[model samples]
Target: MDYQLIWVLLIAFAVFAYVTLDGFDLGIGILFPFEKKQENRGKMMNAIAPIWDGNETWLVLGGGGLYATFPEAYSLLMTAFYIPVIVMLLALVFRGVAFEFRFKSRDHTNHWDFAFAAGSIIAAAMQGAMLGAFIEGINIKDGHFIGGAFDWISPFSIFCASAVVVGYALLGAGWLIMKVDGPLQGKLRAIAKPAVIWMAANLAVVSLMTTYLNPAYGDRWFSTPNIYYLAPIPIVTVGLMFWLWHAVKRREKTVFGITLSVFFLSYLGFGITLFPHIVPPVISFRDAASPDNSLSFMLVGAVIFLPVILGYTAYAYYVFRGKIDDAGYH
Candidate 1:
């Protein structure tokens, strides 16, 4: 069996799951400062309180899976992204701290709120910059990352960071639209149109820059037969973006679902672009994968534990499956 390929798919699934699940909550934090009322901020926090910590489960799975299944790729990428990765981790840690302390404090709640929002924004931007740098390709020689510490910082990376910020804000707004009503909901919907516009604009710029910088990616998308097959991706993406805008304007509850689909398509495009390469533009998954024995051992654990994680996640959401009545955590 192609254990290498299987592990790659599994890792990708975990990463994408982390991105979509945690994205909205991080977005909630991103959108936190914009809502002036403490009650509204609590509502935003409450909307995600049940599942926010749990959503990070996928990040552990993805990161751990990569280290276990593709050690070489893990080490190289981690080394290349050490600075940003560390910053992202610290931001997440601070965000979690803020999440816990904000609701507990009465007099100093605003301080905690600032921590949460700042942490979220920093974490999301770092994540996007790391992604952009990865797409920009790593400097690998003799199976080592030969890149500078600040190689991850660039115009493209900064743009990607901005795009992710806006994108997450959109996701947070869509989520809030589903959870709240009255004036706050109206405000969320009000912001959705501009969010969609910015998201679409960002997507176009990223797409153009990605293809222009990488001939292989350009051929993959625009080559004769490939264009016919891949044409629907961008078309459907634009259609969904417009649909989300209209849905929000119409006060349709499908805003969040459509927003998720847009993110999924964007992720799919990314996966397609970097296919067969775990360490992009350099090492293939097969080359980076661990021995078959190790993979088989891990696969057994994955088969047993993966379902447990998914089952609990689904159950949590099911249990908390309605609009939050109060913003109180407990």
Candidate 2:
């Protein structure tokens, strides 16, 4: 149980890292429709061009870690979310292709831009849907997935998809607030105002939906003793949202930090809401986790290489600091 808990925590941390790091880049792509100028678009791409590839490492880490540590959980999740997962991978491929092709063609730049932005939207939406479906729970029988193909498709998942899109947009807007300035930055600040508002609204809706739609989660949250541990999450989230609103309005550089804080807080709330059980309710992570020897072996490689990954990510960002104004590569 101890090792299982550790492995799950490791995988969860990887997930948060991927969502926080790659999320903004995807958000930048989501912002494509608003910008008409080619140069501005170029700069947008340039801003993320250096570390974009590295940002994807966290996805691999998270997915790979889950598969390694909790094979059963990973297997059931994959079987249930087969289509959405495949679609997300395809969209990510398009985003990568657009990154290269958009730079190569002058006449077809807008065409590639559309592809890039659309890919971001598709990837982000699918991820959100997957998350919502995960929270809603998968159909399990005899410790295996018994649900049909469309089980993940639902209205709640659709709303979650929208929430994820808005969330990524807010993250991207906040990121831009740090990296660029002038008219473009001003516009981002303005855009961020509504993005913040919508994000808060989405958070509210999703929180309500979780408690209403999933009685297990609702009972877990609303019941006594548990609420004492859980109350701080919502309280802190409200405070951060208010602070984020103030930062955006004041045109403070702290928007980026606050945005990251919001993401962290949201992730924290999610973890607290669903813990001990990787699949929720009946199936504990301990039941799904791999044997101790296998987990230990996997954890060894994970711990050894994590620092290297973080170091590389940090160095890449450091080398590419400052506002991007051109299409030049680092």
Candidate 3:
């Protein structure tokens, strides 16, 4: 009956899907500079080639779902973070182009490679900064964003952006560890070792900073009654961090799964920080949702289409489930 809450969870699911799916491809781009060998780079590209485009389907779903289900929040978010949104979109476009063209040209491969890496970095950074800006809260008055254009740029946003880059790279390294073997996999193990360390450090800093910046968040976690329920999240997170380190060192395939759990926990903490609030600190899901009639209508479509999308996505991964070699996926 709570259409508003349902829609919020749907949107959240879509965003998380996008992060987990598209993350590794963007991460591959982030890790490109570290590996200068074209043969290995080709292998890396080959690893994600089939699924990269499909991974972005969740992004479209999330963005469109927000507009349909939470028009007010979408409007305000677009207006408030227009610059970063545009930059992120453009970067994704450029990255896609690089992905397609890099394989086509022999002589200009390096240029396309650089574009892909740069685009991935820029897109990931903008996404992280936008998240930071959203978390820090937006300036709204009488339901309208009243902040200046550059309000999204700040030390916290920059720090968050840097953290996301490292996080994505970590995801990418774990992915490579799973998809490739031999020296490439070994190199990714090295990359993932340091990447996980930095990611863990960043996660700790960001968690502390988030609480320090918002006293309500501090109370939500550390306050007596709430603390009891929330304590297990951080404890499990620490355990997973150790597991991830061990997995990397042992070249275990579970490395990616462990890394994903860490991201999922971070995402869960973020949701906890802003529960019910789509625009955060100002507007809530109930405040932003469409009319009941509209929600009901869309819900019908979502129900019908959601399974199809999931089915196809699962099939694609299943079909390409084989590992990548110098020759490509097999």
Candidate 4:
């Protein structure tokens, strides 16, 4: 296999990891204000506190991998998405500070909680907007961005921004259901139903819009060979959605596992459909990839470092396993 193809797969995996892991924490933050009681909000925060920071490692790896193996795509994307990137960074900083400070300052608890929620919303929105803009393709002429900085704030981008918030909420709810018990778990179970419904609706809308905006996607989906193989992905996705709904309603312990499966399957569908095209019609994997030497060097480092990261992440989660108690941070 080609080194470029290998690097593409690695970067894709990294992106998926980032989205699946850190995504729920952002969702939890967004949902924090919706909880009726202070105790409920604290439960939500405690559920994610142990592993949230570790989850962000995948984002760093994804960005670094892109820079190392596909310098051109990194340069173009960074240039086109400068403003959103900055906003995301600021949001991250605010959220991180708020996460720590909220527990320390009893008097300022409300202030920090608000900051955390606001930061989470902004960060998730900016990420979704950037993704939508990338799918729409950057306006590049002579290898330079020709579009305005606000090019990412269009209708489609806004829809994606809102959709991602709901998506993350669903994930967060699932996580709470798994890690918490008693009243908080019951409340999360109730929340999961609506969150899942919203996510399904948003996914349907995004799919329809994508097909409408790019006839190629419709054609590809309706085509023979691809359709036969790809049909199971959506079919299974809908089935899992229904399964998740039923599990949430029944207050099943496996709801979170099912929810994670749903996300994984959906991501797999996306990866299959979007492979070999990083920025769609305008840019392809081969065109966007760095030189073979660069890819090889990155691959070597990734082989050594990836497992260490995964190992430590697994160990941390294992060590922190079990329900969060009122004993607080240790």
Candidate 5:
């Protein structure tokens, strides 16, 4: 197998894992304000406390993999995305502080809660903005970033950010439904149903914009042989949207699985939509890849370490599995 392709796919897989895992916690934070009862809010926090940090390890892995295996792509991408990425990190700092402080300072709990929610929003928005900007295409001059600092700021990016907020909310709702019971769960279902609708709408808008505003993605996604092969992606995605709504309305415990499936399918579709390109139209993976020896060295270490990370992640989730009755550290 081509070590380059292997590393590329592994990095992609790592990113998908990060989005799906951290996505729920971010969703929970976004949905924090909706659950008014203090006890219920605490329970929401507790449900994610044990494994939230572990969930973020995938981001580090993905970033480290990219920088190690594809330094050129990493350099160019960071050059284009440095500002939002920095802001996103700062937001995560606030989130981490709030996560620890909210438990210690009873009188200022609300303030910490606000910080956590705000941080989640900022991080999610920055991520979505980056995604939108990447999709739209980052400016490059002779293989270097030439885009202005504000290149990532746009109406479409804002819409993508909002969509991610709702999508994460739905994931949070599904998690709450599984891990909590009673009126809180029911209220979560109420929030989730609409979240699914809004998320679906926003996803449609992003898809259309990607297909129309950017002809390269459009050509790849809607072109002849490619269209035939990829048609099931959207068809299943549409079906899963309805499935998620119905499952949420019924308060199914397994809605989390369905919710994750939706994201997995979407991730797969996005990969297909942008196949061969690591950055976009101009920068194919081969173009952006590091030298063969660099890739080969990383591939060996990655092979040994990837499974260890997955095993650890699975173990953490297993240990933390169950209902959340009260808010507190697990």
Candidate 6:
């Protein structure tokens, strides 16, 4: 109902969209070398090539929205996580260049593939580390970063990094299952099973760690009214996970869609739990937001531009629909 709350929800939605849409392609890059065959790698690249660049628009919207609507939170976050942010930017550049060049330069395809995979892994790891650090909360004094930059690399951060890798791998496997068929689909199915199991285990560990590290979250999850309402989210998530496992085992075409839904729901839960708190105890949504005039002005542009972006993205995917055949590449 509050304008500040609306901004928070919009930014959260943008972040979740970026993670869900681009996540599979990043996962595909992480799983690239595991395929061990040139043909399979090409197929995997083709599956994501059409929409990967467009998927990153959500990231731009999320980050830009934060800067415009929550300037203080943005400033503090950027200062605290400067090094990791640079690393993520570089990784994104590497991955984007490798994606295009790998197709153009046949002789350097191997080199580009290496770049792509490394970029993807590094980017995913940095993002997970950032998330872990944010959840753990940063050390700020008088609205300034008061800790070392490397403070982000704790055991929990390491666990989060590994979880992201597994998460991406699951998405990659799911994409493969959806886009390719025959032998490749079989191979992807084999890969998806273990990947899902690892993801489930990692999720359990993260959940436990979050609750143990922050007793407040325990209250959020277990105390009275919120628990009853929020209980269904995790329950549905677990059900979806089981359903994804079954679909993968059966080599069902809808496995990718189901796995993505599971991811979306999990993100929804996280977003809900963290609502109205842009930076946990340090900053509430109302305090973090820019002036009301700035927000109102931004809202005007967002109304017209957001729908256009969404429409073009949908059209691009629709135009490129169906499997990536050998002839599709140029």
Measured on C-alpha atoms, candidate 6 has an lDDT of 0.84
- Kindly list the per-residue Cα lDDT of model 4 for residues 196-284, writing each as its tens digit: 88888887787667766666767777788878978887888889888888888766457767877877876776666566677665777
Across residues 14-90, which tens digit of lDDT does each residue of candidate 1 receive? 99999889999999999887789988888989989889999999999999999999999999999999999999999
lDDT of each: 0.90, 0.87, 0.92, 0.82, 0.86, 0.84
Candidate 5 scores a C-alpha RMSD against the true structure in Å of 1.4
Ranking by lDDT: 3, 1, 2, 5, 6, 4
**lDDT (10s digit) by residue, model 2, range 25-116:** 99999988888888888878888888888899999999988888898889988999999999999999999999999989988998899999
**Poorest lDDT segment (10 consecutive residues) of candidate 5:** 321-330
The sequence of per-residue lDDT tens digits that candidate 6 reaches over residues 1-330 is 366777888898899888878888899999887887888888999988888999999999999999999999999889878999999989999999999999899998899999999999999999999888887887888877788979888999889988887898788888777677788889889888888888888877887787776777778888899889988877887887788888898865677787788778767766665665688647777887988888888888988998999899899877877776666633
Between candidates 1 and 3, the one scoring higher on TM-score is 3
Model 5, position 29, has a per-residue lDDT of 91
Model 3 residue runs over 4 Å out of place are none
lDDT of 4 at 19: 85
Better model by lDDT: candidate 2 vs candidate 6: 2
Clashing pairs in 2: none
Each prediction's Cα RMSD? 1.4, 1.6, 0.8, 1.7, 1.4, 1.6
lDDT of 3 by residue, 78-129 (tens): 9999999999999999999999999999899999999999999999999999
How far in Å is the alpha carbon of 200 misplaced in model 6? 0.6
- Model 5, 1-330: lDDT tens digits are 598899899999999999999999998999988877778888888999889998999999999889988788899889889999999999988998999999899999999999999999889889988988887787887898887988888998888878777888888888889898889988988888878889889888888888876777788888899899989989999998888878887856778998899889878877877888887768888888888888888788888998999999999888888777764434
Candidate 6: where are CA atoms >4 Å away? none
Error of 4 at 101 (Å): 0.5
Error of 3 at 145 (Å): 0.7
CA displacement after TM-score superposition, residue 237 of candidate 6 (Å):
1.5
Top of the candidates by lDDT: 3
